[model samples]
Target: MDPTHSTLLHRLLDATTWRAFDVDAEGRILAGHDASGSVQLVELRPDGARVPLTALPGAVSGRYVPGSRRVVVSHDAGGNERAQLSLLDPDAVTAPLGEDELTPLVRDPDHIHGLVEVLPTGEVVYTTNRRNGVDFDLVVHRLADGTETVLYDGGGMVGGATVSHEGTRALMTRPGRPALSSQVLLLVGDTTTELTDAGEHARYGGLEWLPGGETAIVTSDSGRDHLGVAALDVATGHLTWLVTDDAHDVTARLSPDGRRLLVVTDDDGASRLAIHDADGTFLRDVALPAELRAGVADFLTLPRWSPDGTGLAITWTDPATPADVLLVDAERGRAGVVASSREPLADLDLVDPTSHGVPTPDGETVPCFVYAPPEPSGSSVVIVHGGPEGQSVRSFSAVVQALVGDGHTVLVPNVRGSVGYGKRWYSLDDVERRLDSVADLAALHTHLPRLGLDPARSALWGGSYGGYMVLAGLAFQPQLWAAGVDIVGISSLVTFLENTSPYRRAHREREYGSLERDREFLERASPLNRIGDVRAPLFVIHGANDPRVPLSEAEQVAAAVRANGVEVEMVVYDDEGHGLAKRANRLDAYPRAVAFLGRALA
Candidate 1:
């Protein structure tokens, strides 16, 4: 790696962000911090003291039990994302909780579990796929005797599960088979009722049960292009719209007293918060502090209501700032930073991206964020985001900043199948339509030269699905890119579906199509099939334990390209999965990526 690029990578990796997941009765915040290079649970004290709670190898997320001192943290091994729930003692002043100190609430090696809520009775409610690895079932685990009881087992993916304040009722959301649509189920005692029939092409999520237990609030896109918050009756399946907007409106949380509602709207990729009364009346928009408003805060930690219901604990971030936990007053809308994960950049100039839409050949506009250095390098790198279902929002990205610092323009595009753009746009790249998104990338490359970027010097880069896009671009449009980098991306949709973890296979097949029926289409869409067409130098990175894409995705493509006489480099991380999580591995992998692109683009 070049000395300058190495320094740039160090500066980018040094910045750490903590996400405030939940607050305890004592006002201690449970947050996920990556200060140790791997994400772990931390107790953020009101007095400004930081205490490490869990030292997991991958990402960790948890919440504080309202009435107890114990916290529940969920983490997956490596990056397989089969989350396991564990109990933590916040007062122990422990170095990450050891294997012995941590008590597993739901421990099934072959199954995945997620923490839903911890009741006052010390009973934990979570969703698991133990019954059938493909579907999630809501279960209640009694902490007193360690008894597990299944609450509900609807035959589909359970997105989330939430219990009402009094614990008499619960609400669960299951996305439809296609996933662009969803339905909410209400659980009362032994009976269950469907709350909303969002129909086809509509999606509903962000479930928040009201204190009354009879009514709940949720975000729905039914009969509208944008998402809106609606109050639903648990018994009658009736819904009353509380807030509606042309943009996507999401229900973040309802106050403890159930009087104030924290609502966030997706304005393109930026977030705007609106407050509402319990009776479905809009109060006012919470004024985002200038710092938060300046950059992309699309994924703000779902704003949590304070114990007193007068304020909210939120995680805010942008391109120039790492995430910070802030307490914002509900009445005044004033925000104060409670915990910060900002790191000094050592005088390195960071670029703030400009969001715009690029016109594709089919007359569709693709959203994108561009970060350009001050001096014209005439070279550019297109960074594609994973989740053909995900969007590229404005957020702080060390890789983008580092690449821009190295005098190359960076473009982050939210292609066709991305969310936040309504259901129709989101399904545009599904299954056989996948390569349409690749065409969007080619269109983006064509527009770069107009922005003073030299097409011949430009490279394509991405991870996971984005990584798939990189390979697709190089193969489908061989002359367009000078080089390509793939990180845990799929080279062959057919092989990926066959090799991916069984639990996630169905869900992925929904997006990429199943091998049973669409085998030919999948093969034609795969970049591996077109390896002979790729003319650019290619670099591939993968984690040995990745359950989603699997390590073979990288090996197969790298081998095929090498056989075709194309310059190819492969780097595999044994300790990581899905994506690189540990700080040390990232430090090792990313610098090499920068150096590879630097040499190829130069």
Candidate 2:
């Protein structure tokens, strides 16, 4: 690796990202940070002290049982994402929980469990696909006695489940076939009722049970372009819109007393957080520190409100800084850093990203973030995001920043089928329409020269689905790109759907189409079939243990492209699952990737 690029990776890897998962009754924040290389759980005390809670080897995230000292932590082996629930006692002064002390609540090898919630009764409510291995069902687990009860076993994907404070009722969202459209179901003593008939193109999520347990607060896109907060009556299945906006509004956090809500609005990719009464009366926007105001503040975990409801905990990140956990006072809206992994970014000169909208031939607009080097390097790289359903948000990215530092312009585009936009925009590239996203990529390449970038020297890069896009671009429009980089990306849609983790097969097939119904379409969409058309040097990266995309995706693509006399470089990490999680692995892999791209583009 080049010394400059190696130094860039070193700096980027040094800054650890922290994610605050939950807050305990005593106001201590449970956060996951990469201070030890692999992400581990740590407790952030109010007095600015950090306590290591878990010393596990994989990514672990947990939440405290409302009134107990025990925390329920979820861990996945490698990155296969078949997460299992484990109980840990943070108060125990012993050197982290030993393997014998760690108690596994739901440990099924072939199944996956997630979205855990602790009911007031001390029963853990979580979603699992253990029944049929495809669709998820809600399960209530009694941690005290190791008893499990299937709460709701209905079909489709159980997006999430939330139990009421009294444990008498629960809410489960079943996302419809088209993807974003969903139906919210109310669960009462052995009976489930549909609370909202959110039809096609409408999305519903962020379910929270309000006081008295008769009503709940949820964010829905019914009868609107963007998601807005609304209250649903459990008895009547009626919705009363409270906070409607042009931008997507989501319920971030609710106070302990259930009197206040922290609503987060996704204005494109940047986040705007505001506090509101449970009845939807707007109070004021939560003022963020200057650093956090520049980029995205992730509210996915739901803000952790102090047990007393006087303070909230949040995670924030930007182009320059990795994620940091902060504690904010509820009354004055003042925020102070609780835990930050900022050592890695101490003195690095980082580039600030400028947002742009590129127009496609079909009259659709794709959003992109451009990070340019100080000195114009005619060469450019287009980094496609994974999740034909995922959007390119304003988050810190080490690879993008490093590429820009290496004198290459980086363009991260949120193409047609990305979220953060409305439901219609999100479904634009589903299944048969996926190639339309490839066209959007071509259009972005055409528009790059306008930003003083060289169209002839541009490279296409992405991971997972984005990796598929890189291969597709190289094959479909061979003349357009100078090189390509695919990280744990799909080479064949049919093979990917067939070989992906069984638990995720149904959900993924919903997005990419199934082999039984859309075999021909899947074949036509796969880049493997068109590999002969690729002319540029290709670099492939994959984790041997990846359960999502699988290593074969990279191996097959590299072998096929190499057979066509294309210069192909392959790197596979034996211990990694999906993506590189350990800092050492990242430091080893990323610089080589930069070196490969640097040599190819040069």
Candidate 3:
């Protein structure tokens, strides 16, 4: 009777992750992201084309500097946080800002990415750390003279920095200790003031400055039990809840114009998008096609907004198909599919156009996505998507698209541990079955080579748990792959659950078994304990401030992987966790990845 997720799944199909829209000062039809996540920028002109100034892996957290002639995207280059400040005129290619002038800086293994905002006076203001159980500070730098000063430390957990339209003030959210709760803070020229004290651990998200810095729209969960949109008076530090809810929770996002608020919410298991006036009056429920809402048990969960303000983009899923991006219009009430997301049965190396899906270790057939260039037999990079619980669907992938455009076949697999299939299929790699996922990946070397994928030129790639799979495949089946990459993967699961973030603290018990309760099972699941058998080229990337796996997880593996004379390459972003957020970091990671793949896969 229930083909679609009738619960939380439907609500979250839209905002399964975070996204930011880069509208011009006029908020016109600029180039926006369908699946690029929150990583782009656009320079709007009154007469000419609204140029999208967004650098790939661009500045998701950078502020605009007046008359600077360009925007700064921050990330990590090698070991230091590097800024890719691209000029907007022709394209977003410009010189990169190094750490010569910025100091007291840290590139912790967990938190490694930084955000930049160039001031009219040639000062670059940026957030300097991660929300990884530590407070963050906003520091400013003078380019001409090379002077640095702390704007406001804000206790270390500050995020989402927004400058006033007039460029005099800034708005940011600060998280308190214990992790779940936070408050809003406003920074004046020389003074740091607390903005709102909603409650203990009240989650505040995405603070947007209004026409000027006089006011801001801050999203907060009323009490973790309620969702509301509120406006704050920067002068008085007063917050007036505009949109309040007690029934089903919602997250508020201010539109580009600041006149209307976009609210993402869910009721029961169905997801719905609601538009409301700034004063809290309901506008309209953006409509979704029946088919789009099929298995989307969490609708309010997936948050997406069209650049034109006409519709919301969300992940529409059903039992028959994995969730994919679908455009939904609130005015027209129509939903249309945009992309395909089915995992293939074989290694999909573009070199061999006819390559199909491959058989798994268990004899079950599953789909595989390929990453390679136009040449039928050039270098190859097989990227196994993370989430041993995830799938390699035809969804919007930023990295894959760019790589494919650059002439490389990137293979993405929806292994057995992945969802989109029924629960039984998703539960395949839990506990003792963990190695099954590894086996599925190892088989690719044998299977892909037969299908024309030059195994000698194939490299293993993935992040998080997928990163672990990369290490395992290389260690257990060295001859099967040319090289491997591990991005914050769990080389060891025995301590993963104990040291992991509270949000995911208990997640491993059911998947990998409890260390205290099932030591043997946990030991078998970890590749770190058995690293001596590994012999392959390995490159690892990790966020220093990562709260999930912690930087130590990667360091432990890196230390061992390097000591074994396996030729180890490592990149760590001091201020990032999980994924690369700042523009500088993404750009840094991309080129390094390209080089790493070239050296190994070549």
> All models: lDDT?
0.81, 0.82, 0.57
Q: lDDT for model 1, on a 0 to 1 scale?
A: 0.81
On residues 236-354, what C-alpha lDDT tens digit does candidate 2 reach at each position? 97789888877564545678789888877887688777788888888877787765547666766567887778888888887776888878777776777777655557677788778
Which candidate wins on TM-score?
2
Q: List where candidate 3 sits over 4 angstroms from the true fold.
A: 1-327, 330-355, 405-407
Candidate 1: tens digits of C-alpha lDDT, residues 522-558: 9999999999999899989999989889999999999
Candidate 2 local lDDT, residue 293: 41
Residue 453 of model 2 has an lDDT of: 83
In order of appearance, the predictions have TM-scores of 0.95, 0.96, 0.50
Candidate 2: regions farther than 4 A off? 247-251
Model 2: ten consecutive residues of lowest lDDT: 93-102
Ranking by TM-score: 2, 1, 3
Global Cα RMSD, each model: 2.0, 1.8, 12.9
Count of clashing pairs, candidate 3: 86
- What is the Cα-based TM-score of model 3? 0.50
